[model samples]
Target: MHLFSLTCTDFAAALHQGWGKGMFHAAAIYRHVFKQGNPDLAQVPELAQAGILTQELQSAFNVSSPAIAAMAVQEGVTKIVFSLAGGLRVEAVWIPMPRRTTLCLSSQAGCRMGCAFCRTGALGLLRNLAAEEIVGQVYAVRHGLGRAIDNIVFMGMGEPLDNFDNVAQAIRVLSDQRGLDIPHSHMTISTAGLTDGIRRLGELGWPGLNLAVSLNAADDELRSQLMPVNAIHPLAQLKQALQDYPLRKKGVFFIEYVLLKGVNDSRGHAARLACFLEGLPVRVNVIGCNPGPDCLFESPGEEHCRLFCAWLAGEGLFVRMRSSRGQDINAACGQLGGPAH
Candidate 1:
């Protein structure tokens, strides 16, 4: 069993069943493993006090993280490639800002969404990561890189809702008060128009958890061409899902629009987008497309992006221009993939 895969309550139950330990002892173990960054059960002083041998715990549970295969840093952004079992790999990015640092995490080894603008889609879906693997990314960055992650975004290598079970469990583990203590308010899950997953997440009723929808184009035909998921869940269905999504007080949905030159950056496109988002409480985040090597699309000019945002704002919608980070090292948006890419 992977120790990191278990939640605090699950851990407590395991300890009770295996060694007749109390819930408080499980809490102590959680502190040692997650808060103190000590994965070795032998080093947990509380476990020793409970007369639990290190060998017994070791034989039952594995507390190992994936090996870091490669790391690249450009500007204030750092991308870490973790080599998982069976030679599969995933990437997570550390984005530092003046106010808060955000950690972008991957939900799977590769992506199956097949969005035309993203590099990870080129790899197809390899496998969904386990809860331990998902949580390990946070631990690896916090402990290995020694970076303070103030926020977490599931916008790295894969569509998070595709691996909803593992991702949800990872959130529970990450937010446990006895462990990492990061709240749901600091976490955001982005999807590429997965209506069912969006509705499922809403049904979870997780308060303060943010949701971002990648809507590159407002019109169904254009969006369907850019994102294959759109062909399945068209604009009408996606809009209905958003309309039904539960948002906390003072919470608003985030609409991520990647601007491609001469493609989806026109003022007319922005007007259609505003119309598409007419009833939703959303803040539009306009980002220039991060075109990696041999990409079919091109990033829009700064003035063009500015104009697009202006158009959205003119419609009385909240808008923000997100500047690309780590583009020089191919760690920007839509650029995460294996080392070979």
Candidate 2:
């Protein structure tokens, strides 16, 4: 359910709305209303109104409990995985080319980015998901495939940086030696460049945890228009913050630039972008813009895309064109879950 309009006390009041008797009674009402039988510490009343028995549902959806969500964990060039979303919808996909089995996990119900080209961000923001729910996605995937997921990407539904604490907590829980035990290095967190959150991540000193910044545009003006967060954070400060980001063993942050035809794709624009990252240790992963409904931006021509990468490479920056995998399913970078199935 969407909690945007629900205040803490409002949530409390909902639980207390018709709370009469045992937890199951409240659970029944919450299930009927929210359609999710999960309870959180939003407030006792909200707990009551929501009628969620968190512990109960956690036990119920445990993939390891049933030994499902996994067919096998053997080595493979490519492994199929699902992009789990809120109860509303989900995306099933495969990992990197040739050989891979990694699932991208969504830590929230919906997104608030409202990026014109993105499906999930356009859905507006939903409530932040708890660590269990984040990990629960893995469980669902495991059960679906009856095999273990090798790696994970936090580049799914919502902005992971928006749900920093829960995202970090989920990583800890999933990496628990006794539990899923996926290391920090194996998981990745992609963002639309949340400077504050990125700074916070630097303090943890977790080596090998990959990061991808959704920098669809090269300059500030276009970036702010395409990504609202750019207005508040700004590209200058973001670039500096990224430079300060502690990278383990010369790690390079992935600068994901989605190319569009008329916008941010001209040779002049490419040269300007090359100047933007003169000495940064970064890799440009040029992604093809997946045309979405209501998006005015068109994908750049193949030649222009190549030239853009070439320009950046001439400036001594590592640049590469990202292969369009699952494009038919709209599974390219920054494309994932949404409201409408």
Candidate 3:
């Protein structure tokens, strides 16, 4: 593993004691590797002059490639399939907005949370990506685009919380001031209702980090049917976890509700959802299901999505409807699964 694979603190600890260069060198190296995506460490003047960048460090630590095997773009939403070490493939989506460009990254090769609507879940969990692999996705996309990315969401191919340790390190790497320097508030981790993960995040005390829970169904029975993870950590337990979550006073967590036509989009379901999230500080993001060839679900009509948002708002819940961006290229939510060639 190279220095690129390690966290900032871990990289600092690995420096030679005799060099006495300290964190100044580590920060400079990180800036070159992460912020600039410098492929060759010897190109960096600070590392080169110190004589510490020896053949040993070169052999032990190497820069990870984003390994973009394939790419598809539609209406400015670009999805790139990244090949990891060992032939495992993951995805990252780049969405360019007027204000900020956002990259949705995957923490695992595939997903274990078998949400009925998601194509990635159908593959099962392949393996957890290393912290460097996670960082490599950002480096690859940004390097390819020749642009800066302002936001990141772990909502591409896996449940981020399931790969917590690696994901956490990646977050630190991305937000490090001498590195990518993305604000904590700009990075969001979306999970498939993992209460343990939620509790663990709370314990970490990173209050500014945003958490989005996929609560596709309001009722326990319906939710369990839609998302199998609900059976292990049901709605009640999830609610308790959110209740105990130490959110910042101004922070509002996201509630992602994927609307499956006639399944979880009924007016009654909306009311039940309102009751379920009664006193929580949340903003419900209503996503119309992005249909895939193998999936049985379908998205509700535009009017129905509007009504769902209206109904949630009627119950005094803050709600917004987000349309699927890249359906033609299979880059939309629930449609990110295929052989990574």
TM-score of each: 0.98, 0.73, 0.96
Candidates 2 and 3 compared: the better one by lDDT is 3
lDDT of each: 0.90, 0.65, 0.86
List the lowest-lDDT window of 10 residues for candidate 3: 13-22
Displacement of the residue 323 alpha carbon in candidate 2, Å: 1.7
lDDT of 3 by residue, 211-316 (tens): 9999999888999999999999999999999999999997888999999999999989999999999989999999999887888988888899999999999999
RMSD for each of the candidates: 1.1, 10.1, 1.6
How does candidate 2 fare on TM-score? 0.73
Report the poorest 10 consecutive residues by lDDT, candidate 2.
65-74
Error of 2 at 12 (Å): 30
- What digit string (tens of lDDT, one per residue) describes model 1 on residues 1-341? 78778888998999899889878888988898888888888888887887887798889988788889999888778989999999988999999999999999999988999999899998899999999999899999997778999999999999999999999999988888888889999999999989999998998899599999999999999998999999899999999999888889878999999999998988899899999999899999999998888699998878889999999999999999999988877788999994523
Name the best candidate (by lDDT).
1
- Name every residue pair that clashes in candidate 1: none
Of models 1 and 3, which has the larger TM-score?
1
What is the Å distance of residue 126 in model 3 from its true position?
A: 0.7
Candidate 3 lDDT = 0.86
lDDT of 2 at 201: 87
